[model samples]
Target chain A: MNHVTDLPLWVAWLVAAFLFIGAGLTLTGSFGLYRLSSFYDRIHAPTLGTSWGTAAIVLASIIYFSALQSRPVFHEILIGIFVTITTPVTFMLLGRAALYRDRSENNPEVPAMDLPKDILDKLKLADKTESVYLESGERE
Target chain B: MSATILLWAITFAQIMLAIAMVLALARMIKGPRAQDRVLGLDTLYVNSMLLILVFGIRTGNTLYFEVSLIIGILGFVATVALAKFLMRGEVIE
Candidate 1:
């Protein structure tokens, strides 16, 4: 640890508070991951940590460094942005892969991959109605 | 006055994160399937990165920031690779 005299009291306290909040959010998210039942449900849990959880900590870092250096140090935004974009993509891919494997194995836990023909026809009709409603909403 | 309060809060936060990591590790070790293990690993990586950020705040150093960033990238790649392997039974397929 650096000597205590290096930082002003207020700045130290501010950074510490930010760090605490960020870590708390992260812990909650991870805890959710463990508590949630089923793989698909677990998938949503990490997003809590990846999105706002990562953002809060990065913001804390930016705030701390900028305050200490007396200038804006905003490069930490890169990791924040990278994570925000990549985490969703990874989660989506993993979910899809799991779904595929489950379907291939004919796992009863997962729904059938291809809907019955009647259901597909009904879905198409529903989609058409949805599109028409969307267009009407846009016009209004 | 407030500084002492903030210090106590941060210490509490670190303790929470440590507990979270342990929970994740337990899931990783107890997983019944390969995918579950991979998911645990992913969670572990994200938690560790956040832990590093907290340490950076404690030490007031920008260097730890870089380390955290690198760990994030590495973890992302490793998880993706493992997920791919799970899908195809090979890393490069």
Candidate 2:
């Protein structure tokens, strides 16, 4: 707590503001996760936290540490970069997985496959609205 | 004073993050599908990581930076693996 006073007033204010915004966004995101009606809708919620929610807090951290240490501490950038690069990969994978599962179960809400009719017949999926094509690829 | 303001702000932020984590947990527990649960778990990992970073800022310690970074990496790996498992019915196959 003693070290808290060593921070200048303006820096303190800036950090506080960033903290509030970041935390608020994160809370909203999580609340969305809890309240969303479907898996696909819920999937979009956490990105709010992973994106700007993380950026705000990391920015605040960079500011606080840089001010406290009297030098530009930039190591926090690694977390930012790693998160930015990895988030899309995870989200894409999750979405694809969900889509695959839904199609396998013959779910009607998901979009239809775009393959030509010949391929759909060869795969024994001509009667189905969507497919388990990816599953067939795996089996073969 | 600025110190008091920052302290209260940090405290409030931490509390909010904790609540966010709980909300995520609720989703995980109430999920009707495995994908929903995995999504909630991913959100939980992210919220927990941010909470750790805020904790670092409060203590003025740089070590927590490494800890949070590791948490992020682990979360990414865990989510990816879980997603793969969902897709293939096996993580390594």
Candidate 3:
């Protein structure tokens, strides 16, 4: 903060804007997690923070430090990139885990593992319509 | 003019980030389900990391940046472990 006063007016404003943007996104995302009604829906909320939220903050840091020191500082980029890559992995794993648990419990609320037993049973070998609407995108 | 603006902006941003952490913590505590709690905890980790970065900007220090990086790593690992346990009832199976 000592060197902050030494910065050019425009640079200071720029740093401030980025920091506010980053922090705002993060706060809103967390808030969404709190207000969302369903667990599945809530999972998507944090991605906003992890992605652009992290980006904006690190951007501000990079700008402030580079301006103060008069040289580009690239270390902050590591945090940005790391968060981007790992966040999706965690979310995905968590989603799959949640799905697996729900499926195993035979929760009537969740989709069945094999396309609704009653519907599957009704379809006979003689029907032969679409096989499975998603079979590698190859048309008949 | 911009000097004071910069200071206030950083302060405001820090407060926002801190509020975010509190909201995440609330969700973590109020979670009706295990997965919900895990999601909240993950969000908490991320918000806290961002808060640290804002601190980095405030004090003009590289040390805070490094600390944020470490927190990011820890958050990811912790979430992954918790998710794995939730899926299979075991952290390392």
Each model's lDDT comes to 0.80, 0.93, 0.88
lDDT (C-alpha) at residue A16 in model 3: 83
Poorly placed runs, candidate 2 (over 4 Å): A116-140
User: What TM value does the first chain of each candidate achieve?
Assistant: 0.75, 0.82, 0.80
For candidate 1, the iRMS in Å is 2.3
> Best by lDDT, which number?
2
Between the candidate structures 1 and 3, which one is better when assessed by DockQ? 3
Ranking by DockQ: 2, 3, 1
In angstroms, what RMSD does candidate 1 have relative to the true structure?
A: 8.7
Tens-digit lDDT track for model 1 on A1-140? Answer: 44334557777677666677777777887787788888888888878788888888888778767876889999889889988888977777788878888888999999887788998897787687998767776999
Q: Residue B59 of model 2: what lDDT?
A: 95
Give candidate 1's error at residue B16 in angstroms. 1.6
List all candidate RMSDs to the true structure.
8.7, 4.8, 6.4
Off by over 4 Å in 1: A1-13, A115-140, B1-6
**What class would a CAPRI assessor give candidate 3's docking?**
medium
Q: How many backbone clashes does candidate 1 have?
A: 0
Predictions' DockQ, in order: 0.42, 0.89, 0.75
Highest DockQ: which candidate?
2
Alpha-carbon shift of residue A86 in model 3 (angstroms): 0.2
